[model samples]
Target: MYRYDNYDQTLVDERVTQFRDQMTRYLDGRLGEEEFRPLRLQNGLYIQKYAPMLRIAIPYGMLSSDQLRRLASIARRYDRGYGHFSTRQNLQLNWPAIETVPDILGELAEVQMHAIQTSGNCIRNTTSDQFAGIAADEVEDPRPWCELIRQWSTLHPEFAFLPRKFKIAVTGASSDRAAIQVHDIGLRLWRDDEGEVRVRVLAGGGLGRTPMIGDVVRDDLPWKHLLTYLEACVRVYNQFGRRDNKFKARIKILVKALGIEEFRRRVDAEWEHLKDGPQTLTPAAVEAAKTHFPEPERRPVSDEAIAAYEQQRQEDRALARFVTNNVTDHKVAGYKAVTLSLKRRELAPGDVTSDQMEAVADLAERFSFGEVRVTHEQNLVLSDVPVDQMVALWQALDELGMANPTVGTLNDIICCPGGDFCGLANAVSIPIAQALQERFEDLDFLYDLGPLDLNISGCMNACGHHHVGHIGILGVDKKGEEYYQVSLGGNSTDDASLGKILGPSFYREDVPDVIDKVLKVYVESRHADERFLDTYRRIGIKPFKERVYA
Candidate 1:
């Protein structure tokens, strides 16, 4: 993980002091709520439904054990006993005292972290593949570039205020676990046949009231020109991006209004001014950022451990389920990728208690390399757990209520804290997610369904990324009645596309049955081993829609 230098430390300290004064003035009647709104938003404090919520950024979704422990401390000291991890790779404390938020920021500064850009109409946290450094197919680690953008976007004078919030994502691997296609800006790091690093830049991709699959503006941009190109793109958007209407403010809408060719031309024109500026990446700076991340040292292990692992997999069904569901293949032999489930039964998705946070920190120290990652799907990853130690790690996680092996399954729902918690929400989302979980308790059935993503949002803001789920559910309000809309065939991979609405929205109680009908259609129509998204795309939404609304 990247550590903060003196310059980083100085900036955070100064911001904390400034926000503290701002809060004091607001409370003393000098700063009106109108004047205080932007200040509080920039500090990551929102006046939510019942209390103020503070969002803390976890850059590129990476966290050191020390940082995790610090987070637990903050949760225990400043707010309630738990914090909710967001799909954007950020964390939120729902009960933080508004007056004490500046103090919280001061503590976060001590750990080289902050709440900046986590909210408001500015460039938000830049997320990436949670398995960036350790993924088998990665050409290069993406975190260095993510960190560079983090620094550049933080308090950027040109983009401090925009029509609406902008999001950017990056990934070094071929797979798109970071959901780069749906971001305002998505960068794919790849090495061409000549063995030179380049980025495939996609622009105008977003999901909200108007969901869009981003278009490629630049193919194989040189690695050193990454930041310059990004700056140019933002500069173009700043100059011409929509401001009169909030609904059409995202770059996605702009790119759609002006066709991809025209948008690309406009960005190219803007790049002429920024190509060789100070923001341009240098070889030394890239190498310096890369130095902090490296492959972990290998351990000389006994064949006995491997044999034991195989034997346990063959003999114990529960252990086998854990291994099969939670582990991904790693580049190094005898090592595996471990996903620590944040979605325990009966709990809200992506939420962790303070004690559980500390437990994960301890486990990261013991089983992995004292590092953890927050995935884009609102889960945690212990990236480098050795195969031999997997069983012990599972037992420890089980004790901490972190051993639900439901990764990429129906039970692993992506949900926003809807009407119950968020003032912006029109209807409740968490309960609907829970109802779906209860309705789909059969793990074998879910495995048979294969690779399903059920994303839900309380409103059309798409905070839960409903537009990208294989089965997307959006809450709607019709004359004081709560209803839910369903969409299908959406995906977030390299071939990412927005889902199509099936038909009329259903009442909240009827949603699960409607989903049942849709799944039944898929099961009846699917070829052998075809995934849900594949089947949906192959047969089109008509069959599913017919069955669902029949």
Candidate 2:
């Protein structure tokens, strides 16, 4: 994990002091709600249904055990006894007293974490794969670049007030676990034929009133010119992105209105002045930043983990199922990535109790070198667990009520804290997730179904990333009644595309049946071994639409 430098420390301290003064003025009636709105939003505070919610940034999803413990402590002392991990890989405290928010920010500052840039219409958190350092397929670790972007974007005067919120994601791995394609700016890190690092830049991707896969603007941009190209992107969006309508203010609308070629031309023209400038990335600075993220110390043990691996393959097939489903590939031999299921079917999908958080901290300390990651899918990951301890770890997690063996399955749902907690939500999203989980409980059947992502958002903000799920569900209000809409065939991989709306939205009672009908069509029509997404792509949405509506 990257620790804060002196500059980081100073910035956070100053920010807290500034916000403290701003908040005091608001309470003293000098600043009205309208006047104070943008200030509070920039600080990551939102006035929700019952109380104010504060979002704290977890850069690139990485956290040290000390940081996680501090978060747990903050939750216990200042707000409720738990925190909601968001799809942006950030944490939100739902019931923090508006007056004490500055105090919360101070505590976060002590741990080198803060709520800055977690919200508002500027550049938000720059996210990456949770398994960045440990992923087997990674060309290079993406965290250093993510950290660099974090520093550059923090309170950037030029981008502080964009037309709309901007999100950027990076992925070093061939697999697009970071959901890069759906971000405002997506950078895929790779090396070209001569072994020089380069980036594939995608622009104007987002989900809301309009959902889009970012168009590739720059292919194989050399690493040294990263900052220059990024600046061009920000300049372009700032100048021409929609400002008249909140719904169409995102960069996606701009890209769609101007064709991808024209958008690229505009950015390239802007890049002319930026190239070879002082802001361009240099070898020394890149290498210097890379030093902060040295690889974890390794000991070459006789791959003892393979024995446990074989035992798992032979013993309880359920445990094997759990292992393959929840664990990701690691860069080092004798080690594997483990995902602790915050999506425990017995509870709300992403809610973790204080005790559960503590247990996770303990596990991270014992097995994962004192580090944990929060994924965009709303799950927690111990990214480098030794493979030999797989069974024991599974048992421990199972005992702690954290193991559910449902990663990437139907039961592993992504749901917003809907009407129950969020003031903006029209209906409850958690109950809908729970109902679907119970309805799709058979693991063997689920395994047969293979690799389905079901995401739900209460309304149109798409915080739950409902736009890119393999099965996307959006809740809407119709005539004082709650209804759920389903969209199938959306993808978040390198070949990203938003799902088309299947039909009219369904009443809450009709949701599960509609899903069942869609799945049945898939089950009957799929070619052997084709996943839901593959099947959907093979046979377009028409058949499923007919079956679902018929």
lDDT of 2 at 502: 94
lDDT of each: 0.90, 0.88
Evaluate model 2: give its TM-score. Answer: 0.97
**Candidate with the greatest lDDT versus the true structure:** 1
Question: Model 2 over residues 382-414: C-alpha lDDT tens digits?
Answer: 987777777888999998877788888988898
Using Cα atoms with residue i matched to residue i, what is each candidate's TM-score against the true structure?
0.98, 0.97
Point out the worst 10-residue segment of candidate 2 by lDDT.
Answer: 299-308
lDDT, candidate 1, equals 0.90
| RMSD in Å for all candidates | 1.3, 1.4
**Error at 376, model 2, angstroms:** 1.2
Q: C-alpha displacement of 6 in model 2, angstroms?
A: 1.4
How far off is residue 350 in model 1, in Å? 0.8
What stretches of model 2 exceed 4 Å from their correct place?
Answer: none
Clashes of each: 0, 0
Q: Give the worst 10-residue stretch by lDDT in candidate 1.
A: 292-301
